[model samples]
Target chain A: MNLKNIFKKDNIMPVAVLGIICLVVAVLVAGINLITRDVIKAEEDRKISESLSIVMEGGEFEKAELPSDAPSTVTAVYREKNGKGNVVTLTKQGYKAPISITVGIDAEGKITGAVITSQAESHGKTGIDSYVSGFIGSDAAGVESHFSANHVTGATVTSEKIKEAIYDAFVVLGLAAAKDTPDVPEFTPAGEASLTESEAIAIAKELMDGSYTKVALPENMPETTHALYKRQEGGYAIHLATQRIKWSPTENEAIVTVDGLGNITGIKMIQWNVGYDKELLSAAPVCTEEYLNSFIGKNASSLNRVEIVTNATLTNNFFGEALKGALDVLYPVPIYSIIAIVIIALAIAAPVAVVIINKVRRKKNEAK
Target chain B: MKQNNKLSIFLRGLIAENPVLVLVLGTCPTLAQTGSVIAALSMGIAATIVLACSNVVISALRKVIPDTVRIPCYIVVIAGFVTAVQLLMHAYLPDLYAMMGVYLALIVVNCIILGRAEMFARKNNMLDSLLDGLGMGVGFLLALLAMATIREVLGAGTFAGIAIPFLVGEGYSYTIPILTQAPGGFLVFGILIAIVNKIGPKKGEKKRKEFSCEGCPSAHLCGKVSCAENTELVITSEPEVQGTPEGKEGEA
Candidate 1:
């Protein structure tokens, strides 16, 4: 084909248009990129430097190549040029996704500082800042113990992962000792009395006006009931603890003396773990003698009939459940407790059943 | 008359032919970026700049570019503008650039920009295309802001990262987290589209009916009667075949 013919409108015009457009676009993009390239580089470097400064202040650094055996979570490591410490940047699997963290460790293998650089964890209301800060001053020797002790409840997985990564940093630095298979403590069965059998007799003497002897608890003893002691006169003293109160994880312990007929003759609260502020101190029911005395004459079968203390309904309910459970071992008529359990189960199951039924109905309709 | 025409051309993209709500184009970023107001606004501004710049360039090159290679040429132009915006955002607004992530670079494929290039820009002058792009861009920004406001305030109990006191008070937390998820995005997008449809010009309106039929493939069959009754309308710009007999009214 002739050169002029190649330039004809039909043949070359379309190609020319596309080529010219592409050329112009490439030039425009190149120009903008050229202008931004330096700023973008500086910004990225500044961010890393800023993070390093925050992690370990007064430490001059040089990028150190990660070891061949380094964990995949460790992204980059920066060692102090003057032998001050090391700053490690890591991305570890968190509660939701990979959380980026920066850690600084001194020459002594103690964590100088730690910061969560980025995370997608939803438990921002209960932040991991304090939990992460607890890692400071922790060496590999104490890391495992610290990890077990302080955990952010709602953000447990993420917080645990943070500690794990920090510990991994120590391992990367060769500061961690050889891993030992931790000795697992022997498992004690639940409902085993925290109070000794003799201690129960002593507490039982305070509740009832008679000599009492420690007795083996019934086979159906509830998890909350710690020990049982039978009074010589014809009643039993039940020592129990309940940790089922809302907004608190601590236990509430008590001693209840029940007569032979399963009626409570007296009650004493040994421990009240729930805390109330001064403003609500007047309404605090657990401290009042009247509240404990109110349950004195009530039969364990009708424990729910006692007026629940205002603002302490959860405490009252769990305490009642424990007393009822203890009496059931003696009287063995747990009809009201069974009914309550059933009501709770039904409340949870009703919505789930409705959802499943609706799903099935939709499938059937689709099939039709 | 000329001024009114120009104003109408610009104003129509804002609501009457809104690229997101009314026309329903570029939905991916609209849903993905609108979870937070900052991300949404960043995406909106970036997309608008690219749209306006591409529309203007495409309109200027409309005649120079041959019809056979126009789509590829338009894409090149659009991609160029998108890259330029991406570079600027990455350089100056690094945080926003990080937040938007890949969505910032996805502007080249956003249908609103390409759609306007094919439909309005190629046919109109440079100024008019620029206006259309700006108007449509603003419309997209407004729609995203509306959706993000609802999602952030109700779903996250925050407005642009500042806590809404009543929704997230010290002892009280009243947030519906599901509203920030994918399903919520679709729900809000659908409701907003419905509201626009309700308030905007209807398909059966005399103006829309008359204007839509011009590009309708079966216009000759209907003899330009109302398009409201036709369920199988094929929208095209192809010329009517010569010597075809006009069908009777309602035959289509």
Candidate 2:
């Protein structure tokens, strides 16, 4: 090829233009990166410092080198300069997603305090602050053991995950002995009912008075072992079923009583293997009477206001689903449900309307 | 070349060539970020900064940039400005940076930036290009604000996260949750386009050809045979052909 052809307008011009633009852009980007890099680092450092202070109160924090082979969950460790405590940032898998916590553990092998740095769980409903505060006075030696004894009702998964993370931190510090717990079992389809259908019907009849006729549960109701029933007095009864623990194979059922106005009047734990086991049953009140009473006045829309029982998060969530199922049957005209219908209708109709309009326009054009 | 008046350069983007409503450019980010007023504002500002900077740079280098490689050159310049903006936002307004997410980086590919660069910036003076970019940016911002206001107020029952009294709450009754989702974005965008089309200036005969490649912002860069250019070529060549008796006889 001729040297003149190599520098010709078509061949070299495109390459030169692109090369020059790329060079200019690269230089500009590099200059910006240099200017902002320190500021970005400082912003991150400020955030960490803020979290450290919140977790370990009344202390100045200096970044401490994390020990090699630190648990994967442990992101950073900070030593309290003026105090005998260290703030460890740990990320553990919560119910919905990873929950990041900054935990302060004093030299005495006791939790000073803990603050949730980041969490995917809904803020208000998780009660994570209260759960973390519970660990303030607890010994770190067996923090995982205390989870079962003091598990927060509505925030069970988040609470347990936080406990496990703190436990790992303690084990890292040589304050606690590490013990492995089996991973919780995934939810399975409902199996054979522990309570006979006749027995459930009899219980439902007694709760509301009058002959109860068995009815099919509404679509998309929570897991149920027994068919729902309606009383002659215009109230409904349904079996709200859930597992005793996340890992448990056996199913537990609660008889939810809903009045004509869609309010949950009562809840009774009718069938649970844990209820039958005297030793395990004595550990904690799984669903206290007061806790069940808290749901009494709440309807489907106001179910969010129902306070979760301590140590009964999974059970209450299951109960909440059951209450929702009852309300779905009672007050089927939810605001979201109506919106859903409208959207679906529009989705189906808009395309059809367009096609019809086009046909009409085409016919008019043909006539003209 | 006739120097375009600065006011026309600015005013044209607001009405005649409104980036989102009229031109129908950069619809993706416009719809996605319009779910909230703050998000839309942040997106609009970020996009505007990038647009203005890219336009000025492209206009300044217009003579130097070879015609064949202009698009890639424009892209690289736009991408640089976008990355710079991203870094600054990340450093100073970390929250808004996090909220804008991928959409901020996506400004590199936004057609409005490249479209303006190819059509207006490459031909116009630097000052005019800068004004054009600012005008288009403000037009996009106004469009986003309009869509976001309706969507946020109706869907979320909030304005910039502040709860709108009477429109929200249990006793007051009525909030459409769907308005915050993707479909609501389209609905609001379509309505705004229709309203803007009705109230804004009617398209002149010249602008009626906008749908064709002749009026396309990227038509010159696309390297396609534009009808307007072809017609002009024929008209200009026709007189020369008529001067020759043989060519006139062939045309007749």
Candidate 3:
């Protein structure tokens, strides 16, 4: 039969042939990917480990795992020979995305080293990149004793997040210390702290039930910035994000009062910026509506609070900044959006623009 | 007209139908995970496997799959592949797996995998679908590589983390200041899209396109999660079925 005649049948042979060919082709491709991945994974892991060793006190860095119930997301825990039990590298939410870092500490619960193992945060300034190495050889508590890290010189929020992440590491290790798990077992970094949104909510609920979840710095609250959205009967059902919120709840109306940790972590009812006022704030610059909103329903437990941004106006601004900061930290935003949009726009415009530019040139030639 | 060759499969990813740059199919991982070239490449490959494997299985079982549950079946197959990759990566390539974060799991929802299943694999036999899947995987890889190349060099002052001498570090030559921030990605994406669009066929000048997909998005906002199952496909399928001899058979 002629090759042309083969097309006339529209037979299963074509499909069958195609099927067999495709099966072979697909198996081959997938096989290649699997094999290639092995090399790629080895190469990448070696590189990252090499980078980690440079920042951390150099050692074999044995992998450590947290108890299933203990909260944290770190996958591998490395211990120093001195029983310092430091350099727990894992992931954590930073200014943009989950930032992977290796935190180094001494036996006394102080940060000696901090390094970004891998980061999806803002490009250059997780602070883990810039000043994290400075932490090396210093005590893990150096952040508390030494100068506080300001927002990144260029990338403030990102820098602050890294600093806070270091602090979070300290808390994890410190709590481990206090628990008489004095051997200082491995503590989870954020990557291993895979708490989903609902889990976050659940964590908040637990803190309220007299759980000592908040093992971080926090001070007692004296005054609170309050905002009551609606006038109600038998007292207003006050809205509070969390127990960390310092202000007392009295009926429907609530106050934006609380500086650090606990109930007031995120937004609650009428968030600080939107339905509330910027001018009116607590005497000590009680956390703004945004801050209050953050901890709207968080567990009221132990967490040392400090005056991060004092002054009434400044406090509200801090709240606004904090909420925006929180959202910005949570999402990578325009970076990803921009690339996607630009590539698409350029792709579509290429064909049209080419034709238009060509037509214009043609018209000019005709006129000539 | 392109031949099904190794070079073709590789090159196709670089330009013709990039999952990120060209097709704009899997935007979530591209946007959320690619802070560096390493992250992007790892995600691309992981996703590529899921795409390729799922395509093959779906093709193999096409006859057995009842049309009534096609979508669900496709999802189960794709998700199974994704979960397998996830476990494998977690066990062996723990670092890359960890770096990918929630995005690693989010691969199931990635439109690219589903789009390939619905658009190509479901309809075609094993070979063409295999070719198409490979082409798509490469395309996605290229798009991710391109994005990472830009983001790393400009946004972070490094290329694959080598820290180029004059281009970025100490006595750096150039940089988009905003790109170091989150919003910069959007600004860069928009500008590049405009430039790329300008390079293509001019607006309204012989609209019959060459390589563009029939339901491709507007070039400017191509990856904005706009696709929601093209309604026109559903509408037009019935009419198109009436035109051919196959239509009579289908009708019968």
Residue-level lDDT of model 2, residues A106-217, one tens digit each, is 8787888787755535322225667777778677755756754245555566677788898877766667655443354333335655567678777776666666778886
Residue-pair clashes per prediction, in order, are 0, 1, 99
Residue-level error in angstroms, candidate 2, position A5: 3.0
B158-221: candidate 3 lDDT, tens digit per residue: 8777877767655545766566455665655555555545673343233543333335544324
Candidate 1, superposed: residue stretches over 4 Å from native: A1-8, A53-76, A79-85, A90-368, B204-252
TM-score of the second chain in each model?
A: 0.81, 0.79, 0.72
How well does each candidate superpose onto the true structure, as a TM-score? 0.51, 0.49, 0.46
**Where does candidate 3 stray beyond 4 Å?**
A1-103, A107-109, A115-368, B1-18, B33-35, B91-95, B155-157, B169-173, B201-252
Q: How good is the docking of model 1, by CAPRI class? A: acceptable
| Model 2 residue pairs with clashes | A153-A313
Q: Is candidate 2 or candidate 3 better by DockQ?
A: 2
Write down the TM-score of model 2's second chain: 0.79
Each model's C-alpha lDDT? 0.76, 0.74, 0.54
- Candidate 2 segments whose C-alpha is farther than 4 A from its true place: A1-4, A53-65, A71-73, A79-368, B1-4, B168-174, B201-252
Tens-digit lDDT track for model 1 on A111-209? 898877655454331256667877888888777677433366556677778877877787778787433222421111234335676776777777778
Across B1-252, the per-residue lDDT of candidate 1 in tens digits comes to 998988888888888988889888989999988889998899889988988998999999888988888899888888888888878886898777667766777888999999999999999999999999998899899989999999999999999999998899888999998788778989999998888877787744656646765555666665432343353233232243322324422243
- fnat, candidate 3? 0.00
